[model samples]
Target: MAADDNENWEDRPLIMPFCGQSCWLVYQTLERALGRSVIIEPGLSWTLVRRQDPNMEHLAKITKCNTMVVLAEKLIEESFDPIVDRHTRNNMIQSVVYNCGSNFPRTNFSRFYTAILENDGRVISAASLRIPSPEIAEIPFIATSEAWRRKGMCRKLLEAIESALGDIGIKRIVIPSSTEMLAKWQIKFGFVNVDYQTNKNIKELNTLMFLKTTRLQKVINPITRKTADLNFLPPSSPRLPPAPPSGQ
Candidate 1:
């Protein structure tokens, strides 16, 4: 299908940065572009968390809901969901699209990724990496389907995106979260709360977090090319800046 044709299937206005096709196509594009094979186990099956993988093990053991983490890196291709009826899935997608707004085409510098349930080709979670400059990339709109909560899908999607970004030398990640829970989760994943001054355009509900792979205390200005403390902000300081002009 043409890229334009797939726009309607998206839940939000933001354009996905990778190949404008299925999640498998995006995965393949990342692998080829980064020159590293992307390996994600296929299937929605469950497995005992290995003791060596303490983080997963801890999460698996502590959850009160008893929802086992679906043990897969990527969803299996062309699988079908036995439990979710077609009507329910369509309604869920429609609700998400309605709430998320009109289609916004992606730019060359930005990339998008998603985690899907192999059964029925359902997108369980998604993320975006926007490269405003060579040294910095912002991760926006990390969302998971309501019906697929606590399944470890978001975590896997994040891991895949971060790994790809790191491999390509984009180490700093700017994430604007909409809730305290999300902020705490980002912190747990190594992001630090910058607590920068709030942008007038952003609602009071959101919080901003920044993270760097290296210990360097300085961040270079994307526009000026001058190095400054990581806390620096542009004059506009409009929280996370909106996506660039649609056509660029």
Candidate 2:
């Protein structure tokens, strides 16, 4: 249907950067344009996580892999274009990067990483890493500039993030991405796919993929006590009546 027709479709589907059409201008515009009403439906995204990959096997072979790390705050401005440019040309990467940037909500910008490799103490490649959320720290991004893809640069960077996270007591991670190539790499790295995709989407334009790398231990306890937990109650306070009905 036409873009403007989205408003009337109360059944309008949830799109990315937004949970529902209630907050999406484009969806509203489309509904208006097509004269189709919208109906709010149930579809929301889920948070996922996993531990970072250490890449011990590859790091052992490299002689001069100096790990100089850059955290999320450091690489916030740099786009994911370099790697995207390699897979898809610079133009497509630019377009996709721009689209992805503009579409995602500002709040989802928390976890991110970029790494630089040093060989014999010299910089080797442009690297970028990211963790989507604090709760689901399972998967991270390790992107090496096109020139450094096959030279074990990515593996080194992965090891760096892996070590960093482990030092901080983060044992699991979850990556929210999906592609045939990525799937293959994940398999090689021993990432077990949880295979759970959320109801969240960017309208009909895109679908998010969730791959679980680490499963955290969940503790379940039975709740036999029914009294409302006083833990949520306020401190004891005596309330006085309204001044004897205003001095009646």
Candidate 3:
């Protein structure tokens, strides 16, 4: 969400999904107090992509970059906070409240995984999952420091995130890319472009991509009563099961 001061955001409202109801209410209250126009800015458009294959676990094992991938939940469990400053510097909180609300400890809904170089113990790359609904998870941020780019850190973090989600029965993931090259690069990792549109406010094209994991398939049974197969349907389709009842 951070941009150069010279760039104009067209005075649009910022649209970000919170990980918990409390954070959502807090943001809403803040917006009401400060006015939506002051809080939201429209500048960059991002492409959305998804992946569901646990087989992608191999990508998480890349050792050529001399870094190790670990779940942020584990770090929190051990009381690690050195990387908090790094996340702050990157403006991670402006995009989503991953560090607040129900995600404070570690829940299946909002989890952050990171990559760190062994030699210096410095975090090089990271990605977070925000489950807006039981049926969908969004990766709002997947960042690698400039010094770590082109070293497979981002890919490692991505693979780790997908593998972790698959382990817990998450079958869908959504990613937003800011550039065509980034969207194209994601295709190699199993994402497919499903929609494209031009954002008049940002003056950029936004591509939406998705992937259905093969691990868990909904099998509807007439007698047994099971969920229907509405994978290809839109999220709001009536046939799809209602979102998880939990606020998180």
Candidate with top lDDT is: 1
Best by TM-score: 1
Instruction: Count backbone clashes in candidate 2.
Output: 46
Please give the clash total of every predicted structure, in order. Answer: 3, 46, 4
lDDT of 2 by residue, 184-237 (tens): 556554455443332121223232222433322111112321121111111111
Query: 140-166 in candidate 3: lDDT tens per residue?
Result: 445666666786656555554444334
- The list of candidate 1 runs beyond 4 A from truth reads 1-37, 44-120, 195-248
lDDT of each: 0.35, 0.31, 0.34
Q: So what's the TM-score on candidate 2?
A: 0.35
Q: Which window of 10 residues has the lowest lDDT sum in candidate 2?
A: 39-48
How far does residue 209 in candidate 1 sit from its true spot (Å)? 11
Estimate, for each residue in 58-129, the C-alpha lDDT of model 1 and write its tens digit: 453434111212222122111212222243332222222122222432212113222222223334554433
